[model samples]
Target chain A: MKEILLNSENYQPGLSIDCVIFGFHDNQLKVLLIKTSYDNKWSLPGGFVPIKEDIDTAAVTVLNDRTGMQGIFLRQFATFGSIKRKDPNFDSTVLDYFEIPKDAGQWFTQRFVTIGYYALVDFLKAIPQKEDNHEIIEWIDHKEVPELILDHKEILDKALHTLRIELNLMPIGYNLLPEKFTIPELQKLYETILDKKLDRRNFLRKITHIGILKKLDEKKSNVAHKAPNLYTFDKDKYEEVLKNGLNQGW
Target chain B: MKEILLNSENYQPGLSIDCVIFGFHDNQLKVLLIKTSYDNKWSLPGGFVPIKEDIDTAAVTVLNDRTGMQGIFLRQFATFGSIKRKDPNFDSTVLDYFEIPKDAGQWFTQRFVTIGYYALVDFLKAIPQKEDNHEIIEWIDHKEVPELILDHKEILDKALHTLRIELNLMPIGYNLLPEKFTIPELQKLYETILDKKLDRRNFLRKITHIGILKKLDEKKSNVAHKAPNLYTFDKDKYEEVLKNGLNQGW
Candidate 1:
């Protein structure tokens, strides 16, 4: 395909979308971060808005570029813009890491505005695909989240707030868990994000009554305690639950 | 206080918030609209980004300007910008109304990139204040809606979609109903919006269980049939119910 260009010398001034891809592993809610090829410091998985692409599409493209994943559950959590948001220091970490001249930074961090989107994906299914010259990818737990390159920390917090609301209104585990998982694992995921203990029996009853889980007769291979039954989400039933606004308790 | 310049020229290029305010009266959903003092025909209530304002605040400003109401529920529904979204005849209604000066029209239209928000308000409470030059205000019901100024029909559709979801998740009647109402009055509001007949007894049971209503000892007066008890929204209880994300059904 021939390369398409519009006003080639400049990127248009308009809205841009950024994605904060969140996942759960080892009982900790984590976010995917990339070390920018331009500057080696960490940044959330993100990209520029395509001239023809919708803002939502732009966010999905960012997710696809960084993780080689698509069709995941993504949502617009918030939009962040301030005159201060465009400060050159927004990409300072990248500049410092590459030992580039101060003047070179202008080529990238010039005036621009961004809208933030948050997404949830199964950690096991997300394969990090670094673009050529890009640095390694990392999944850092919320506690260990370092000072991200720019306004990313604020973006991540907004994503988490949106995620919590989505969880109560949908069977959120579908995007964050394997096809078949034990009830204990499901409970762990909720406890991790909510940071609270749940009565296992009540949680089990609620999930089962929602009729989104089909219990499997399988048992754990090895464990100190009695093994819990494995269950898989009934996709059709779950979709129906979602239509009624996923009334599950947090 | 010194008068602040609120024109678009005084601000830097940034994202702005536009509100699509909807009201239900006389058997149809109505939108609060105005013709700009400088232009012709109607458009959704909207405004520019205030220098120190959060984008959400900008949306509230749009709400306050046209409706003279505040602290009601307003939600950011979507962001609309495609390169072509800037075209002078983006939807033609505005172009023909303004009799666009061919040269300048293209430039002005293309400059804006707006994030859309929507709110549900009781028509009785909205006090429309003219903000711009061609500022003729009216409540245009959804069915009788004209070819709106620009991309506004799309904006209104999105607002409807958000309101539908909100209705299913919670009792959102406080925004649409008068302070004193009966169970049937509330049910009628839902039936009208959702366009479905609900089981009367079941609907009443569900809403009462939410515990957000303060039932008055006095009953409805001058009705052809048995009068239902009047009720007001219990703010404290409603806030408590919000913590519980879902329930049986609408």
Candidate 2:
């Protein structure tokens, strides 16, 4: 037991923060991912938490460095820590041919306890940047997301779950969609996230009753059927509802 | 900057987990507290995380030791860190009281980064116990709580804030009340935590519509005025609703 306990001394410990930035496009939810320039491996945009910084601040720094957006809705979701999760091979098949070391022989697998935060941003508003000039950055739809470099797929899954659970109560989907969206568009966002279909009339009625959507007289220009009226979220009203909370839908 | 960083090495490093256990009784929301046996100071029931253990597991272990409950509704709410949050107060307090050399000063402020977990429990079902037999454990209503020894009061406040924000969607209140309670009892509990008065009839209607309450034929027999009907949370239904989400309330 003593020897086992002492082994912890050799364990290099550190903290890191990862941002699972979610975006919505083409009626599908997506996460912003960077294809590492070094190894062509894809993963969530992340970085080490500085010793002098607040952990949440470190998360924002990571997001801003990669996405060039500040003051976004960044939420600390959960902290991931499994001894096996720290294994370098835990990354996807892309690393198989890299001839990486068994352990910290690779910098990526060093024992790190990472606090995961999710950011909901209008993809159009995000000016994606390559930090440390690594690989290509892309926004992959959640459904078709690649087998990411590390436990990034797992991280993205967790962020989606948090979003689904917090969707109605918090002002989230607005940040993921276009500035102006129809009721069907908004409903489709919820449907994609929750992985379920909803009665269109019921969903529309509920959302409209919330009193945060400003109905615009404009309609979908090119759609074949009757064009649905466009609506935009009243930012101030949405913020008020978020601060006070609503009890209508999951 | 290099000199300041080097001077920080003189501080020992450690990690801690704080459990903010919320309990409800007599229509008042309360929190479980333990008076530190070390200095007769009041604080939340918390302890250091074992190096080999997962942080969440360590949180559950500490909580079970303090509350004698297993697998309750516990959640990692936030992580607290501040340079001064880990000053050598405990050792100094002890040394000043005993008039001893502060040789063991590091024993007190060992630069700890503590992750905070907020838990909800049916106080009547829990068997509270002290990890250290000498620790004085008690339940104090939120308003009546004492000035805690460390940053515990802030931890408790943050936990409550998380609960209030989530109360509309999650069935967390069930953890604070008994297996059977009146609608009024549940409403009172919410009012206490939210620090506001809710319309009684409106509260009942909203609570019942969630469809998680199983109304029993029983009633409060000896209470003054009209006796209220007894109800228990439909566990299966509650779990289902959690998946579905409770999304409507003012």
Candidate 3:
């Protein structure tokens, strides 16, 4: 770790990258977390960009190092630059971790403006690097995410929020939604992604106006309410939209 | 200029902020640009972030310095950290500007991972800092944007692209779209912002599905195919969706 400072020329000081790597297995979303020997709290896989490195490539390197692989579905989502990027116990915790004098590793103590990237990967394929190395890593179910260091929890939440918004913009629904579904069922799909209730009338009106779905004569049977009209994504239109994006949005 | 490196500890090394300040006047979007003495080329209003300052605050300070005012409507759009971020002639041009030896101000020659921020300001209200001070600043119409130094043009184009996306996500059309309009007119509004023609049938279907507009019984009398029905924004629903954001998007 002391070599990090000894070879300071290789890194871009005050800037870093954090990644929220998501995986889906058994129908549950999972996030990659690592526990350093220095702290019990887990953190998103992350690292600094070298002086000549592209920020995006730096994020890829972090993911590659932890997952022991590369070419995961990745994207830049947001950059976090608030004071929150600083670990609350940094001066004591990090200095203690490095076994450096109070003033020796001032570089590590400075606030980092970190770029955030999120990736969706096949859960079964991604293997956490190793626990024997003393750096314990695991894929925690998102719902069970534990306490994290710095602003990582916030970063994770933002990535999930971005994923929800992406559900609106991208064609991820083609894989998630049923082939034929009613307006109520469609609303449920959205609600499941957001983890919140949305207004029924507005949702119906808005979904209808967006025209991604083609209403069919069939109706879903066995529902308590009136048998709602069944619909399927207008394949051509949805593809066109997933290509062009929504005309207007949030 | 030399003071930038002389007081290097005051700023975050290799990290900077660039603002694409956009203004609307006389029915055209204008962008703010500045030309320094050494460079005949124009560039977006930009500066470095201080070591201890928030990146957002650094953006505001850049806005304050150039606009000679505070509280401009600003938000970060993206961060540029590719090799293209380094000015092609940074070593020669920047060193010449500061009259420093090639070896001395190496910091100025380094690659900057700049945070991109864009501001929409009241063009008439905000005054540009004086030109006589040798910084030739102007609000150039977006269409008439001149050749810029570095990746400033890419940054500006991206800001415009983000604004187009904002037209979908933000409640901007509440003010731009007339109180009552036709579907064709609405389609035209989108095409105008995007600067490209959209397939009429697909656009109509997608726009209606988004559910932001309300169909009205009244129809335009002007000669047209079937006298298209007039429409108005579904005010309550639009406000609700805007506040919450589009259910999902790219």
* Per-residue accuracy of model 2 over B46-128 as CA lDDT, tens digit each: 76544456778878887888788887988888877554466445556655543444664544544455788999888888888
> Any runs in candidate 3 off by more than 4 Å, and if so which?
A1-7, A91-104, A173-191, A196-243, A246-250, B1-6, B91-104, B130-132, B173-192, B196-242, B246-250
Residue-pair clashes per candidate: 6, 7, 15
lDDT of each: 0.71, 0.73, 0.75
Considering only chain B, what TM-score does candidate 1 achieve? 0.83
| Candidate 1, Cα interface RMSD | 3.8
The residue pairs that clash in candidate 2, if any, are A37-A135, A247-B247, A247-B248, A247-B249, A248-B247, A248-B248, A249-B247
TM-scores, one per candidate: 0.80, 0.80, 0.74
Candidate 1 chain B lDDT trough over 10 residues, lowest sum: B1-10
Error of 3 at A64 (Å): 2.3
Model 3 lDDT tens row, B35-93:
88877899888888777778888889889888887766687878889855666675465
lDDT of 1 by residue, B191-233 (tens): 8777779899888888888789898898999988888789999
Pick by DockQ: 1 or 2, better one: 1
lDDT for A117 (candidate 3): 94
lDDT of 3 by residue, A1-250 (tens): 3454523377777788999987754445678898988787899988888777788888898888778766766778788898556666765665666565665567676778999999877566677785346678888888999999888999999999888867655544444455777777667756656777889998777777777888898988887977888888988988787777764332
iRMSD for each candidate structure, in the order shown: 3.8, 3.5, 3.8
At residue B125, candidate 2 shows an lDDT of 81
Model 2 steric clash total: 7
Expressed between 0 and 1, the share of native interface contacts present in candidate 1 is 0.16
